[model samples]
Target: MSQKRNIFEEVGEQKASTPTPQGGMIDQGRGGARRGIRAWLMVLFAMVVVMVVVGGLTRLTDSGLSITEWRPVTGAIPPLSEADWQAEFDKYKQIDQWAIDNQWMELADFKEIYWWEWGHRQIGRVIGLVWALGFFGFLLARQIPTGWTGRLLFIGGLGGLQGAVGWWMVASGVTSGEGVTTVASYRLATHLGLAFLILGYIAWFIMLLSRPERDLMQARRQKEAKLWGLSTGLLHLAGVQILLGALVAGIDAGRSFTDWPLMMGQFFPPEAFSISPLWKNFFENPGLVQFIHRMVGYLLFAFAIVVFLRGRKSAHGATRAAFAAAFIALSAQVVLGIYTVVTAAPWNVAIVHQVFAILVFTLILRARFLSGYPIVTSIRGA
Candidate 1:
């Protein structure tokens, strides 16, 4: 017997649509369950990309401390006229940093750097506005998923706190005297640390939303001993290494002595621990910091190769791709660092090296996630 169509079924045909990850006519696929959050997270992550690039520019131009002011409300506007510029310069002059170090630098010269700092702040303000509008709209639109709104709110709050942290970093340099030209090394590291934190959260959210589950290759997941533990450890190790790299950059450790494998001379420089009490030098002495950073690089490369070989034997698409990407990125970063060293940290190569480090960092994360840890035997639905 044939089934009969009901009146509601007939009317429903005209209005019904396949539901999205959210209850909408959005992407309708097996993995589309969390797409709305993913799309918005992508938007937030894009802004973070903007933040990182501009932050790099701020470092390059040495404009990080030019403004000497941090009024969230009034500071949103730029110094337009000559009087305005002079007033800004005058305020900067009062700081010990200007009186001692950059005192000879002209007001016109100061303005050049000022533009970079101004642009950084202005862009941040714009990002804030965009985030506010997006966040509030999402809540009103009922487009946001259940628990993710709180998570996104936390991310937003962290971003807002970043602005104040930035000022705190800037303050440390000037506190010493009027002539201070650079931020304290530790403060610089903290600033960069938060950026890394933001990037990690963004990447994590993206991964969770975009591809919550994937089929594991039995051949790949089974073949392991220390490779799994070793690779994961190395991933974390690389993160710690990056933090040391930041310390190196902040303190101008490159100039300490740039002959790899030997700081100034000898397999291990005699003065590596010259900072007094061996442990102290690891964090303070430029020579030791650079040496430790290089050592970490060597260990990370060795670990990567081990993972590459193990994954190569398996036929998993994601695993193979991740291994290949990580290996290549790490190799490129190493080469870039070598160039940066030989050239004594020229801004161009150094900056590229830093950016590549971030890329490799992400690749390392991808490899670890695809490594098929605790749930290796779990089957994914097609």
Candidate 2:
């Protein structure tokens, strides 16, 4: 039998046993290999960025329609022999681009363009392989964080859809009767818009995974509601501008004017709606499309400035810095956009503009994210 201590006895005479310490549920399991998963995502992110640049190059080279078919699996193996190369070139000749534009291209020229398209598709395939491996590896290992299974699956689903849409975009140009040399502008816009959407989702997930769950939870309590709203609006506007930029790229609209602050030396482009139907002009008319893109870009920059000013007022030093970075990117992008226009969208300048657009987009997202989950600073601003 155990002896009980008298209430009046000296408390220090008896040693007390303490219970083992345990972390709260929020901190339990440490959110399932966040660093490992983030590393995987970073790999995927770099691949996607490469894919975008290669895609822009393919379009600029007019090589997108060179393949003429979407053999997702079989296409991975490019032509291995002279006969196979001829067969591929023969297939390309059936398209309007070959008939109307690239008839001057011999077998060697065909191979040159062929490689650009092939490399673009190969990059895409590699990206898919990487995503599948990382995602399923994490899955079978059961290392996926809570509430993340669906998010990962969503990205995979979008990848599959993007592949299908890519074929759809190519098919639009594969036809012979309509004299369609390039893919449909709207379809190109749709394909590119989906790409950006997927990129945006990946970026957001990376940001979320960067911090621990408990820290994120605690930071969420200090979310700046107004700043979040403004940034959200800015993000949407940026999306629209990106789509418009895609439309501009789709039809070589950027090369049409080659002027700044004016289109053909006028505030408005003449023959803006020259197409037979009113709606076709919006998609097919280079002047009008470029004008719309320019107008939206101006509006987006103005809105970004407004958001930046508000972001400067944030109490958190990190949040303010994030916004400043975004604003600076915006300013650079605007200058790049102007240069892209004045230079008539040369392949080099245009590709830089496109890649820089991604940078601007990512910086804005970073600012927006910090606004929602700000990093806390010490009194001395550590």
Candidate 3:
């Protein structure tokens, strides 16, 4: 048998024989999905974002609790005939919310809620189909590199979790003594929270994958820590603000106490502490919930301002740009929120306000990576 050469030495010889590109010894290993699950995650995740924004519209229109049933398989095809429409309405009529919560709702009126609820479910069905198709395509195309099966599994698993959660949220109002119960605010928060968590991670995966496998040794330790800190903080604060906003929604606080300089004509309403011995109002009371959301919003704005100023002198262009964007977007969000409140939470204005929260959440993450990581990467390269 011919002698087998050492594999490491063989690799060295092959490396020496292969032509190096013009830039002294071009890096051979690039283009890794080391960016993680991003390339495949984008399309599916983008649709999820659409689902969320539209879901917000659905909530504002009071469409979420309308479906009144959890028909996963058969319900996929909506009312195809007039008789079918009436049948759907009959099922809806049995709910307490129909008769008591919304008195005098017409049979024709039933069709209105039917469509919004229909659209939401239809989109979910599409998302489920797309996910299945994407999974099959990956198996056929063989684009999923080794060791990444787990990640994709997580993504798909979470997508399934979302479907179940959607039902769980809607079901909360199903048995209400009143008409189709209004969606619970906490459940609403949980659903939105999971959607953003997935969205943000996919975006980050895309951002990271688009980058080269950098020489991160210098930053290999301390730098990632700093970046992680700033990034996680930004994410945490944004999430908290969103939760407060949900609390406001749950209490239907936006519709109550509609003045800016004063809620019910006082610096702080007597109702702020009207709930209990002391602390219960911070979470349970509508007036206090929205008011605290407003105050926390101001704090978030100020936090962004301070972070951006610190980023400007840090010398990383991406970090600076991302921070700048976050600050600007935060400012716009604050303004939008103020407008939504003062204007009594118009559907258009409130939806826009929520949309801007996603945009700002994105930029905050972008800046988090920009923070000391770039400089650390440069040092490692040297």
Candidate 4:
């Protein structure tokens, strides 16, 4: 009261000392090396993509059965001497693939297929090592963001399970008396399906890590729930189509009917259900499997159209653009599917189609992510 002054004095003239309130945990530790974790995930994503392509080529070349055993650790060391090569070839000869299909394969010819399977396995080992080193390294350094440990560990666990499932797929063909020249079609589908699942997880995590947790939390508040739901449905539909495509590849079904708009000049192939027990035809019959795959492809494209239309209504420009890109990818994928079929599923064309499928998948995932956590932009759309 004794220090009263003029009432019209400027407000800035007073300076009261007050403590600045520190933010919560996220602002304290720089969010635990998010950029570093994201960089590591990007590397893993590329490796998984390569692994899928190589695995496809391995299947396309009929080289998956070259290695009869799954010596996860020991198998990393390929044959160094001629004797070791012969030993591997000897194992290959015991399988029905040798007795029924490749009866004329010489030791030299055997080595060709051996290298494909070996390379595929070697890539897997490298992926595991990279994941282990990056994960444990960050873990020891305490650089992993909160709530990410379980997510990282889940990917590693899936990688391990994929290895086991891969062996299960190969074991189906390593028989002496079943006249089985290829792995079981369902098992092949399972293996390919798991690969895509791992890819999806890696991609999701990378996107999450690209931004700070605070931003993600804030963006999530404005999520387009309906669009996200639609995209989620589209994702599930695409997953089924992927599995069906795997079945088609597993039995070489795409090569059986090399026509467009119709299979063998008709709406359906003549011997669609020739396989016995009726149920076996869906998985074992080439004609039926390809027909199913084609039908599903059409359905997926139609659904994609619906999702695309819905995405166009989004308020966020970035979200709309993401969906547009995804739609274009899906369209290209459909064309690629037709081309692959018309060309009899040659390895070269088939691999392109497979890789494009991955592209479409990733784009769709991006669109879905944007729907959930849209990027805020200025009025000028910057």
The lDDT per prediction is 0.73, 0.92, 0.73, 0.93
Between prediction 2 and prediction 3, the one with superior lDDT is: 2
TM-score of each: 0.81, 0.95, 0.84, 0.94
Residue runs of model 4 more than 4 Å from their true location after superposition: 1-21, 24-30
lDDT of 4 at 306: 96
lDDT of candidate 3? 0.73
Model 2, 1-43: lDDT tens digits are 9888898899666456755568778967657778998898888
In candidate 2, position 307 carries an lDDT of: 97
- Give the per-residue lDDT digits (tens) of candidate 3, residues 1-382: 9767876675546545668656512223333344334645777767877888888888888878778788888888888898988887777667666766666777677778778888888887888788777666665666554545566667677778887898998887776454346776778778888888777776665565554444433333445354457657767998899878877876588888788868888867666778776776775688888878888888887777777677676555556677788888889998888889889998888888888888888888777765635644254454
Kindly give the stretch of ten consecutive residues in candidate 4 with the minimal lDDT sum. 11-20
Model 3, C-alpha of 296: deviation from truth (Å): 1.2
Candidate 2 C-alpha error for residue 94, in Å: 0.9
Q: 1 or 3, which is superior by TM-score?
A: 3
Residue 141 in model 4: lDDT: 97
Off by over 4 Å in 2: 1-19
Tell how far residue 47 is off in model 4, in angstroms: 0.3
Model 4 C-alpha RMSD to native: 2.8
**What TM-score does candidate 2 reach?**
0.95
User: lDDT at 285 for candidate 2?
Assistant: 97
lDDT of 2 at 105: 92
Which scores higher on TM-score, 3 or 4? Answer: 4
